[model samples]
Target: MGKSKEKRLCKQVKHDVLEEDLDGYKKLVVNPTHLCVKCGRVCNDPGLLCEPEPID
Candidate 1:
């Protein structure tokens, strides 16, 4: 797989945040239901995270 696809959203968002890519960030966190345990980043899809835990 390509590097981008291999990377979880948690890691990808770090770069997006650094570059101020608000649009990209928004697309990843539209309606977050899970949070990354490693970085505390929230996303709708748990598969996108390296370590995800349900928000509830």
Candidate 2:
């Protein structure tokens, strides 16, 4: 009687989803999509968004 040995191979798959980018990120940059909604949506200015509303 002849017996054969079985071999098993396993490998890991790595995906580079997140990358380290510091080309232009060396300086502080203001986010344009950021909203300071403190007052209301009528105000388009970011600085004016923090204005207090008038009392009734």
Per-residue alpha-carbon lDDT of candidate 1 for residues 1-56, written as tens digits (9 for 90 to 100): 23456667887876666376677668779889999989888998898899999988
The runs of at least 3 residues in candidate 1 whose Cα sits more than 4 Å from the true structure, single-residue gaps closed, are 1-3, 17-20
lDDT of each: 0.81, 0.24
Question: Where does candidate 2 clash, by residue pair?
Answer: none
Q: How does model 1 score by TM-score? A: 0.70
Alpha-carbon runs more than 4 Å astray in model 2:
1-38, 51-56
Model 2: lowest-lDDT 10 consecutive positions: 7-16
| CA RMSD (A), model 2 | 23.0
Clash number for each model: 0, 0
1-56 in candidate 2: lDDT tens per residue?
A: 23212210000001121133233222212233223334232222233234333322
Model number with the top TM-score = 1
